[model samples]
Target: LTPELKCDRPDLRGNLVIKEKAITYQAGKEAVTQLQFERAVSCFSKAITLQPDQLQTQFYVERAEVYLQLCDFNSAALDYKHACYLEPQTKTHFHRLAFIYYLQGQCLCDQGMFLDALESFAKATELKPNFKPYHMRLACLTALGRYSDCIRLVTNWLKIDPPSADLFTLRARLYHQINQAALCYYDLKAALRLNPSCADALSLLEEMKEAAECSRQQAVSKAVEGELTNALSKITTAVEKNPEKAQYYLFGIIYRRLKDFIAAIEDLVLAVELCDAVAECSEREKPDNSNSLEEDAQAQLVLTYNDFAVHCFSQGFYSEAIKLLTKAIHEQRDESGLFINRGCFLKQEEWLFALADYQQAEELDPQNRSIWFRLALIHNTMGLHSFGKNFQDAADKFSLAIKYKPGVAQYYGNRAKAHTRMHRMEEAKLDALSALILGSTNDELLRLFPGCSLSDVISSATAQTVKAQLMEQTQMWKLAGRPVTEAVRKVLHQRQSLYRTGPRLSPLRLADASEAALCAAKHPYAWRNFRGLGLNC
Candidate 1:
């Protein structure tokens, strides 16, 4: 009977069923030999159905192979799993299952199902912890961006197996992805030492070195151009690639240039930490070589703190800036610039603290006129805020300022105001006259006096008269129900000016009368009504 007919009749005859299934299995084998995978699959399915309990594990495996050839990975995996179940103790069966799982994972990877593929390959490795399957699992993990998992897997595998160049290379690549460049370099070196002919390891090592150099050069170029953000990115890459203390220092420099004081401070702190660690390690290994890195790191730390303080000041973070400056001053006690900066920040809301800082700065550099001037200004401001309550202190500060820089007229004028507030008329006059001789204005002098000159009084009176006249005219226009147009306002303004300068005549001058006549002439009826009312013409 034909293979199809035999498969269709599984119970044709109990005595002949076994022989019939054997014939069907032979037909499936022949189909497979001819590479007709679909026909082979159909025949195999029928053979298994004919005598399900009698089927050998080889039967399932052969059919699974056919399924795989057809690229039906899911079906192939199932068939291979069934083979493994059928012959649980057979090593070949488990190996075949693992191979099928590996193939399934590759298919999943091609379809961009990285997570699923990772599971599949992981299962394959679990089923057969062989070289190829383990490596495949690592590759799948890498594709999934699970570098940590890959590293852990490789590390565990290395503990179990003898170290090989290929495994070392794989672990090195995993380290590279996570920015553990030192570990990556160690692995690459181990890989090359094991197999001196490993082209990939050598190439990777060279590439890392070249990448670090290129990054350093590009960062320097960007920094020279003041492209701070771009420089930061390049330096960051360099740090990730090499992570030397010097690279960290450069990263901090870039951050400082960007005015990211907080980030800069953090990076510099990290650099110092790393440097200390290195120094400790070196001392343990060779004590004579320890001081260089520590010394350089200490210097850089002080500079970093100073730069961080400046940025904090610019951003108006006075408390933080003062803290950073204090840290710098602690490290470099004689830095007048640091003391000055801290004093400037303190002057905003902490005058006493600011005064102390300026005093320290003055002791350090007594000839700095700018420092004296700042002290004078701060004292004057403080006196103003405490006017009549702290006049002596204000006068003392102004005198100190003039003592340092005797030619400044502003110091004398400010001192004169302070004395006037204290009722020291003689001292106030002397100071005011000195300020006037040194180019202070009369207005500045008048501020100290209780009364102005007669001419000044007369000018003030004239202004008041003009202001009253304008108001009266505006009120009169509103009472008369007139719109008070621009021409009428101009005439009113001229009338006020005339009253101010000319002799008093009926409380309105001849110029005002002529202006009124002009306005009345514009409306003859209004003028006639005015005369009828017995008003002055």
Candidate 2:
């Protein structure tokens, strides 16, 4: 109007103000976008100071993102809280706050602050319901062994997202921990269909599908380990509550580990009878109660009976072991180890009965070395010293046992006994020495072969030389499969005379038979088999 000159000045002040504001806003946005989080933080702070109310929530949210990027989660959480405060009803604001809390919880988890992480994740789920974080927290709770808490969390998560593969997978894992294999498999199948690439879910499904087959076998192994820990705790409680229930089968497992085979059998037999009574009761009266607990109880009883019988046979309780084993066989006649064990025990006490049992067990499991060893021992013990046949047979079985259990010195020692019985003295000595080297210190065996005195051996070196000559002639006879010749006899005579002087078998005459040449003049054939057979030749 009146200030045309002022207008002509191009509104310099206003333009300058607009240009400064644009520059500030652009710098703040650029810093945040480029992930220069520290600079972005500063820039945003400056922008907020310059224009307090303009894009306030956006600025706060951007700065919070930058803080989170820098791993300053607590700081980012405060910024997000402020953003949410600025926009109370905005879903994005609540979601942003929840995400920040979730990230903070993850950091706490990585630091092993599990309780803190659980609280953070709980808070996140409260602010914004989600499928992933709830499952994640469920995993953390499971890891902490907080089974009840995990069940509650996963149950809530499942309600919200009934078809969520992750929640199903998590719930399946919890159910598996609680020994709910059937329920676990149901959930696992659901997860597998939803996410086939989930390795954990797939692996669990495979284990669950094989559960029936492995359950009895695994129950025995678990019962062995658990008898010392939680299994014992449960058994103790059960016994305290109901002493007449014959839960003493669990005690039998403990006694079996302690090697009290007699006690184990007694408790296990009673446990089996009690289990049978329980089964009868369940069938007749408690028809509606068809739970897995009752099934496992029955399975445990059967496994305990089998274990007891196996142990009895192993520890040489022949008659009693046979009774229990026969009972087990009548119940389930297909178990190879049961037949083998009973056969072995019977063979030890009554060979005729044992022979039929062993033959049956052999038909069932021909490749089992213990059964073979027992059979071979029986043959050898019953006057069947056919070295060509029995030795070879026993050798094969012992070799197999050695391959399976190389560290058990007794196996090697047993093979040595077989070799000794066959008149393979050097081979037997080598095996015995090997057994001793492997920690089999048998004083009885050590006393059987008197060690040579150094002086006596040296004093008889002349006689030894004559013996060496005779041995050499014998070896020549054996190798050529004939008797000693005239030339060899003459050489033996000279070697005998020379051996009386000093260790006169000179370096050249020492030949390939170093031990024979150095020791004395025994019949070279005396050591022929020892050397040719690769012993201390």
Candidate 3:
């Protein structure tokens, strides 16, 4: 052999380099077989660098495998991408690179890097043109409020034969965002035609059938046209089909119109639950409009509850009405009218519950005269069952009612009862007089002491009768020729105090409508039954 070694032979040098590349590739395979991942990555990478561009695809793919074994995903993804570029005709490399991009997009999305994630997802769609990448891209775009771009993407994809139902449904969802109810309806119909069992398409159809809350519009129209049966039938079918918020709401309202309160209540409850869920989901998918949607849902729920409650009350289902109004109050805690209506319902059940509700309403609107009146009634009932502090509370509540409208005879009459309960005779007499002047009868005032006996009570005798009795006794004492005793003077002062409660409303000054005012004067100590309709006044 010559010492020059024939280095100028270009073909031999090329042959040697090819042999070295082959040996390096073989060594990489051996290292991978032995599970020496670090050494395999180094060997495969060297082979990829030394191989010709046309032949480097296999080496890059092998290096990517080793990098995967080493848990170096970024390196593996780069190697797979290079393999795709080297061999554009091979689908396996393109699919692998596309999958890597999808995974990268998912990671970025989870990290809240929506824009970066979208770029990776778009690249995956460009390479694969499949469903998963499109779904990810669509979601990312929706979160970014790029609904127009999503519409374009879904619209282009929907051009395929036997068109994808899921694609149409997604486009409809985008249209819903842009308030294009007409387009949403068409797309939903197209989706249903493609695949009748598409759940999303069916629900959306229920939402946009008439382009303005479908079932509700149709149901209301049918009802107004004197087709109550047809309205109920339509709403029932819609509920069975979708059971969505609007469907349930319309169904409940139709049942309410038919006076089927039980069914109305059940459906309204379901609608409220669905509305609550939608409001929560809006917090994530539509944060910009979430608060308004939640508020609107709350208002709708409250109104529905109140409507059902009013129907329940008319049907004499007091308990059901009270429960519905209670739920309404829970949905709208600040709505004073809800509390007022609930208090009225609870009046037939228990005065304590009615009292609490009326108290809440008074707190919301201090100047609400009706609330004050209701509270007065509840407290009067409480006072009848209680004494002391409760009686005082009843009087105070009456005073509040009178403060708002001082002319109401019912308030003064109730205050008289409360005062009598607390043994404030002076105040009770004054209130009794005011009540009589304001149109309450003496019989109503007498009912204030329902089973109470006042035989020895000082107010039972008139000042004229006491004075005559004193005159007779004085004549008798003069005949006996004895000075007046201290006890007799004390009795005279007590009689003066009783007469100072002022003259009662005389029958002469009373209006002709108050003819019952004279009954108390003829029988000054008679008690009447308190169970009459006029007792509240």
What's the lDDT for candidate 1?
0.71
- What TM-score do all the candidates reach, one by one? 0.54, 0.34, 0.39
The better candidate by lDDT, 1 or 2, is 1
Residues 1-537, candidate 1, lDDT per residue (tens digit)? 899988867566765878888888999999988998899999888887877654666778888889989988788888877887887787887887777788888888888888888888877888887656445766667877889998998899899999999999989988988989878888998999999999989988888878877887898898899887888888777776665535446367666666676777677777667666765574457445345544545555666777776666666677887898789888666655566777755436687788787778778766554566566666655655565678888788777666544555677788888888888987886676556555566586766545765245324644356446434644553444334556556556555444476643324244577878986654322111101111100
Give residue 275's lDDT in candidate 1 (0 to 100): 63
| Lowest lDDT 10-residue stretch of candidate 1 | 528-537
What's the lDDT for residue 382 in model 2?
37
Candidate 1 regions off by >4 Å?
1-96, 99-123, 126-168, 174-207, 217-234, 258-263, 284-331, 390-394, 410-433, 442-537
* Two-way TM-score contest, 2 vs 3, winner: 3
Among these predictions, the greatest TM-score belongs to 1
Which residue segments of model 2 deviate by more than 4 Å?
A: 1-22, 33-35, 160-172, 175-537
- What is the lDDT for 60 in model 2? 78
Which digits, one per residue and each the tens of the lDDT, describe model 2 over residues 1-537?
568877866787767756776687688789877767788888777766655564677777877888888989888888888888888888888887888788878888888888888888888888876536543576568768898788777787667665777878978888778766556777887898988888888887766544443433444555667544444444543343233445435465655565565665566666656656666774566435334334334344344455666556456565666786676566545455556656645444565576566667667655554555555455433323333467766765665555433544566676777777777877675555545545676654443246843334333544355345434643553454333655566556556454376764433333357865755433211111101111100
